[model samples]
Target: GLRNYVQMFTEDPRYWRSVVTTLTYVVIAVPLQLALALVVALALKGMKRGKAFYRSAFYAPSLLGASMSIALVWRAIFNDGGTVDHLSGTGGWVNKPGWALLAVALLTVWQFGAPMVIFLAGLQQIPAELYEAAACDGASKWRQFLSVTVPMLSPVIFFNLVLQTIQAFQVFTPAFAVSAGKGGPADSTLVYTMYLYDRGFVASHMGYASAMAWVLLVVIGAVTAVLFRTSRSWVFYASEGDR
Candidate 1:
């Protein structure tokens, strides 16, 4: 058992590729996704009309993000001679390693609706009096946002950060479907879970796959622990109650 686990790190180059690819997704997709979501949430919060319709419209993508149909649609859009290439006058991005990964990241980033809703709720919960006081102090809109908006939103930001980071690491369906279940054009889009599926199902390497699953769990757990440990310095709660 232990030997098989060790061999995954030492004997398998594909394993390392999966690790790097998953980290790439986490690093590239999660922050951009959250940032866009926060911006949308802030915009929605400031709107006076058609709020429900706009919220639902913005949220539709997250509802269908994991659906097989969306993946197929994405594949069509990025495939050779597809819409992206047709519009850009460039070659297909799907078959290229770096570009393919970016295409997959784009899919993840597009599904920011859930976090946006969460942020919207969090923004609403912040007392308007805080902003009023900030404005009374002659704070500009940008300064008020940096001081009042962000501090109040810290807890929500931390919540979304942890949840999205975990979700990003587990991203499999987009890569699997976009690559047509092969993680191909040279394993560039082979995320960790995709590789695990290939190992356990396609290659029949159940032992190695199981080892990989456990390692992934450990890695996520360690990262989460670090986040939680550091959160005390940044994540603010109104109920911290004095000092």
Candidate 2:
């Protein structure tokens, strides 16, 4: 059955368009989210006052982000007559394709807590002496950060990149909840996994969906492999070869 459907879905331009849509979202959302998280992590490192409070505050949204209640809240915020539209005053921004994609991106960006926390922990483990040593050598903050901070944190960054990329590729709940399962306003928000759901469950094209699932697995695996191979030149493991 999958054999039959694979041939059909592959030949269908509409199905490929759905695949491209999902890939585009993952490519944009994942990197931007991680970059923002890294910046937040850098800011929080070594702060003395209100550290616990701030960390918790930043992390709270992520913890609750995927919950049904939170998804409903997001839906309300982006609805036609919602606060975002009222603020923009454009009357129908949410219904527009560009704004709708942006709204989804914002939803993904809001869940930065996990990666931020990971980066914070990684930043903490980096020795303060490294910074001090760089300072004594007359290295500017930017230079020291480039030469030392980045190298030391490369392993952590690599880990987060891989994990988050996979998560972004598999994203479903936010799109489903925010778009109300219709993918919204002209299928602009339809992600690959959501498409898979439509095919497998809604359309009862189980075989086709299964093939798409495997294709997704292969695509993710290939991307991950590329990251790992590229990392050999960048990621500096402290325990190199001890494993």
Candidate 3:
């Protein structure tokens, strides 16, 4: 019975579509989020004024993101006549699936402060002498960033990558809240975790939902393994001291 349900849903095109949508979200969101975080962290490093306040302001959204009340607030803000649509002067855009996806993407991007804080901590640990040495050698700032900062930060980057990948794959609240549970006018916001919720709880397809969960685990594992394999080429371990 369980295997049958698992096979049934896994074979369904709609189920696959949800998986693809979620994966696409991760593909587009995670890298851009990390890039933006890294840039902000770099810029904020060594700043003498208002650092604490700035860091707290950036991280505030992360603390609010998963709360039920906060989700409700987001729902109100993205509803058909909510602040966003009103500001854009496009009341109908909320019903458009593409815009729904973009709305979810924006929410995801706005939560970048957590990763940026992590990156800031990582950047601070890097010795200034490394940058000074680069400068002495007439290395451009961009070159110094690539050759020194990136290499030194590889471990931190890898850590953030793995953590964010797992989190992004399981993103549900924003999509559910922003799209108002219909997954939007065309199901554009139907992320995999939301699909699993619908199947397990909504449809009472517990066995099938369990299968989907296992499949998600496998997919995450495979992606992480690929990242680790690729890291050998780029990830610099300080213990090796080989540069």
Candidate 4:
């Protein structure tokens, strides 16, 4: 049992590559998704008409995000000479090592509705008087966003970041479906969870996969703990003064 654990790290260079690929995916996908979500939430917050319809339309993709059918659809779009190719003229995305992971990341980004709703709720909870005060003090819109909106929304942002980061770490289906379960082209989309699945189920390295599973749990816990630890510096509570 323990031998597999030690050998997984010591014996396989792919373990390190998977770690790098996983982190890259998380870094690219989570921030972009949250940024897009926040932007959409802000736009929705200011809208006076057709809010429900627009929200539903945007969120519908998230409902189908994890489905195999959507993944297949995404594959079709990003494959050689597909819709995206016709628009961007960038050719296919999933067949090139440099672009395959980005295609997978984009699939995750397209499902930003859940976080957008959460951000919208947070935005709604913020007192309008705060923005009024900022404006009264001659703050520009950008300054007001930084000083008022971000501070007020920090908690919600942190919440989304944690959830998204955790979700990104477990990403497998999109990569699997897009790459046809092979983690190609050239293993660019071989995220940690996919590699774990490959080792355990495909290669029959159950012991190694089990070891990797425990490590992943530990790494996630440690990352969460680190985020909490560092959050004290940036995450502010409205009741902080009471402490």
Candidate 5:
């Protein structure tokens, strides 16, 4: 009933916290991941040597990052006295609420391989003649990138932005595995999906869980709609002619 849905917000404190955490994760992870991916894509596009090796090496993380095993590996690395602690000469990060989320964000950013590859493909499709013309007009390399590379690749950038935003909101494995399924350390790592799982399965409040799921779906749809609408200003399709 709609009453149950209302209670999800009014009666639930954890639900709101989860919402904040999820949004924070999306805000922090998606842009950083996309930016790093773009840099990597640009680097790969300019490389004349070992491109294949570098591409494979960079992309390997996205292939295995979402797996249970990799999540466990992430947990170990962030846990007390784990690899990061050993390397940084500090105590465990995963046990803390603030740092644990950052650790998870790092893991998310590290899996930028998929978008990087897509960006590389987009870069390859850009016409080289445009760059030559820009150079002839006395444009600097930076100016050329701003004028040519960005506009040409805007479509691809929009694609990755929308896709990664959706993916970021659905992040569950990292929170689940890294927090040991409890969203512990004071539930700071508890994401939207994790809270939904607890409500549906652990707490046996399936109705609330359903409400949360529907809300999430609506949120994603609305965000996507907004992106598509605003994209007319920024996302330049090739058919629209050069801006």
Candidate 6:
């Protein structure tokens, strides 16, 4: 019964590689996406005109989301001798072992609209008077962002962090399509879900696949729990302060 689980860590070197690859993808993709989204959200928060248009335009990519079509388009852009190579005069990124995972991660980072919108909403909830007070106190914009914006937005940041982290762990289509359903050129892009799919469907090892699913769930839960635990140190809650 537990043989499949045991084999995943003990017998299967590939699974270990896949786990590392998945973590690398999540660590790279999620932070970049959140950073981009937060920057956009901050810029949009200051804009006085055509904000809706810009928001819609920025958000269009998230609407495209993780579809096969989007993934295929991404693959073409990064694939060897594809559009990116034509423009940059370099070999495509999708084939290189070190660069392939980053290439796939870029696709997800490009769709930063969802978190950007959430950040914008959170920005809207923050009081402008707080900024005015910060300005009056001779706080630099950077200082204001650190003292006022981030502390106030910590809840929203934490929320988006959890959301993006969980989503990143489950990413499938981008790697699948970018590598043509093969996490190659050397399994550098072999994500957890992609490998799980191989075990479940491609190889018909249903029991092993199910075990992998359980492992994923447990990992997600454990990571989420750790986030919640550590968040107490930095995550702010005005309600708690009020009480």
Per-residue lDDT of model 5, residues 134-221, tens digit only: 9999999999999999999999999999999999999999989999998878888899999999999999988888888999999999
Give the clashing residue pairs of candidate 5, or none.
none
lDDT of each: 0.92, 0.84, 0.84, 0.92, 0.92, 0.93
Number of the top lDDT candidate: 6
Off-target runs (Cα >4 Å) in candidate 1 are: 241-243
Q: Each prediction's TM-score against the native?
A: 0.97, 0.92, 0.91, 0.96, 0.96, 0.97
Model 6, TM vs. native: 0.97
User: Which run of 10 residues does model 4 get worst, by summed lDDT?
Assistant: 234-243
Better of 1 and 3 by lDDT: 1
Q: Write the per-residue lDDT of candidate 6 for residues 1-243, one digit (tens) a residue.
A: 686479666889889888999999999999999999999999999999999999999999998968999899899889878998999887899989989999999999999999999999999999999999999999999999999999999999999999999999999999999999999989999999999999999999888888889999999999999999999999988879721
Candidate 1 global TM-score: 0.97
C-alpha RMSD by candidate, in order: 1.2, 2.2, 2.0, 1.3, 1.3, 1.3
Error of 3 at 184 (Å): 2.1
Kindly indicate the candidate among 4 and 6 with the higher lDDT: 6
Cα lDDT of candidate 2 equals 0.84
Model 2 over residues 1-243: C-alpha lDDT tens digits?
656777897788667767776787887888888999999888888688988888899998888987878876887888878888789777544477666666777788889999999999999998889999999999998999898888889999999999989988898888787788877767777888888999999999887888889989998999999999998888898778412
lDDT of 1 by residue, 123-173 (tens): 999999999999999999999999989988999999999999999989998
- Candidate 2: Cα lDDT at 231: 89
Candidate no. 5 TM-score: 0.96
Instruction: Give the per-residue Cα lDDT of candidate 1 at 51.
Output: 94
Per-residue error (Å), model 6, residue 196: 0.6
Compute the lDDT of residue 50 as modeled in candidate 6: 92
